[model samples]
Target: MGITDFFSDVWDTFAHPSPDAEAPKGGSSTETPAAGTPEESSEEAEVNKQDAVKSDESQQEQGHIPSDDAEEEEEEEEETVDPKDKLEADCQESKACAPAKHHYDECAERVMGQIENDGKAKEDCVEEFFHLAHCATQCAAKPLFSQLK
Candidate 1:
């Protein structure tokens, strides 16, 4: 699984305590950690309750959910140091570029920083610049998406 998934599994494990597999007893505490003192048990319970509250609140917040862009970037970065991840990500149009509300970051920067007469980086920036324009045009209903894929 992914990093978030792995972390989520760990969090689930710690947060939800279930009855022990072999414990069908009537007297022993099967759900809570057994070895802790009374004070520690109370403290742990309190902490868990607080964590639950925090997790629920975060889930309800606006526009904070994980995005494919972030996950892909993390995966690609882990796998390689090539700038092509950046280039490929910069030019994508559909769901790959969805996480960005309006503009892909690098393309935005390149377009905004397009210096005329000084054509040093102009050749390099051409691909992203056109792709950004085409993507925006598609979003505006003129439809340039098919031209890329």
Candidate 2:
């Protein structure tokens, strides 16, 4: 038997505590049950067959898919938008952090210009970047977090 079947058999042994389940003479614990017994009954087989037929019938009734647009829409609907994205979008839309953002952009441009001209940047934009982040976070935190669970 498979590992799952063996585990289930072990679980059944412990749950029921049957006396017939004696330790094997020479074989290991991973041994399968004797081959004479059937794994599933005829009734069980018939029920499984019926279920498969019903599933096929349901698919047939649904008919052909029109286009991939429906699938794309479903995927978009299913996706959970991140809260950070909402905060960033709100910050951009509100323009409350515009001054800080402009300063950061100027610092970044200066660094890039230095690198292009001299093959090295005189200063990193960490201070300006942190100022911009602080402004954005302060402006966006209340509205964004209040809506989240």
Candidate 3:
């Protein structure tokens, strides 16, 4: 997906969680049917119970039995890494692009300084900023890409 789409998806995921994710807050999965409505047949409830048992057995057979809380905890752990930290770590690992990183950082500093001290608008530097950023990123990826050849 394009960067805009990707970021939009991330924003949506945070802003609007799925119904399944909100179910736990109600304290029970089985909800009582409204008055005058036919209740689920005994056979259907038994089948559902059996299915749940089978699912738990299969999960145990594979290794560990999964629970909603455990799954949520795993998801939380996976998301614990901050994006800025990941970017810094990646830059550190791309040692061959040290000069490019330095140049990119210097350019950023100069541009930001001009905007702050000289009353220049950030719109005036978007193109130059992105060009330097692209150059730096490509330079950083060059060595890694060459290894795949």
Candidate 4:
């Protein structure tokens, strides 16, 4: 049908190979023969086939490729946590959101106070979340964390 197919067909006809003609040494088409006598020698292509088959089999058994699903599950489990853990779990979730959630919450509270209450207050209660987040994260790391209080 194509140039390669036509050439391969003609080559096959001339070689007069039987239907069961064995594949070359490594099962590949390209190999250079080492040394050949006029009557008793195979082409170089066959030796290359042996090398290829050996390499392919080695790769299959050794498994050089890392597992994608396992890595992803490990990362997902990083974010996954228990709801009953409450404060500890919240700390993990806060980290997932970023450390600035408290700072932003404080800013929002100040804005709300400015809108709802007097424009000038002696002191506004600012809820600093970063400070709390840091303290909580540290506390969770301790063995006797409650003693730290």
Candidate 5:
């Protein structure tokens, strides 16, 4: 599938969750059955559970299962690392990023200060913020550009 198709499918799944995925909250339903019986509800619950198992099996068959060890390692690493530290590490890894680091830092601080002190909405600063981000991204890709020349 093309990238657009793949993203469309992902968007559809996120926008509309499957009915069997989650139970109705507070036992409320728009359509009440005439019987209103306990046995029927129990049977429906059993069917939902079976459906969930089948869904999981299908995902596994399609090679969608995640590695438990990788997940655990990621959780452990997240607990030990701060977000700012991670961003700094990412910047340090790129030779082009080093020169633009000061500019990016200044832009970030200004944007944050405006949002906090001036009560400006993040959306209001998107244009300026994205410009700074684009500059940094360009700087970070300089090495690759030089190699092509």
Candidate 6:
């Protein structure tokens, strides 16, 4: 499931716990059923337990371990998606901070030009840089904060 779905499920579990659930707080439906239902004989229960043990033993003997690819995929997905980068890109693409970005770029270019043409030390564009950063931060803050824990 996606992050949104996961959070939604968590919210739903707390907000609308099933009345028939054994515990005060409801649990996931994915849990295994309780053992020894009415239809199961004692002999059958014993046989089932033995079968389960044998299956486990055979798996261990064969070195057959379950893959955690799903977990790995989830981790990879999170690692690949940098919310800050995404937010910054969004701000740039939307041109919400265009004026500030343009000013910063102009200041940088002017500083570089002076250094190259006049053989002078490069001038700092701290003010312009901060102005651009502040604009981008303003655009990024809401979405970026929402994505983070």
Candidate 5 segments exceeding 4 Å error:
1-40, 70-144
Clashing pairs in 4: 26-49, 26-50, 31-44, 31-45, 32-44, 32-45, 33-44, 102-129
Please name the candidate that would achieve the greatest lDDT relative to the true structure. 6
What clash count goes with each model? 0, 0, 0, 8, 0, 0
Q: Between prediction 4 and prediction 6, which has the larger TM-score?
A: 6
**How does each model score on lDDT?**
0.60, 0.79, 0.67, 0.61, 0.66, 0.80
Q: Write the per-residue lDDT of candidate 2 for residues 1-149, one digit (tens) a residue.
A: 89999999899978985677778578543344455656656777899999999887877689643358877887778667788767875785467888888888899999999999999999999998888778777877787778875
- Residues 1-149, candidate 5: write the lDDT tens digits: 99999999999999997989987679556575556565456678999899999999999898788879868887877454444444445545556554455555666687778889878845354555455556555554655455446
Query: Residue 20's C-alpha lDDT in candidate 3?
Result: 83
Off by over 4 Å in 3: 1-38, 67-123, 134-149
Model 6 C-alpha lDDT versus the unseen true structure: 0.80
Instruction: Tell me the lDDT of candidate 5.
Output: 0.66
Alpha carbon deviation, residue 106, candidate 1 (Å): 3.2
Task: Provide TM-scores for the models.
Answer: 0.18, 0.45, 0.30, 0.28, 0.27, 0.43
Instruction: In model 2, state the lDDT of residue 90.
Output: 71
lDDT of 2 at 32: 46
- The TM-score, computed over Cα atoms with residue i paired to residue i, of candidate 5 is 0.27
Off by over 4 Å in 6: 1-80
- In candidate 3, how many clashes are counted? 0
The prediction achieving the highest TM-score against the true structure is 2
lDDT of 2: 0.79
Q: Using lDDT as the measure, what is the rank order of every candidate, best first?
A: 6, 2, 3, 5, 4, 1
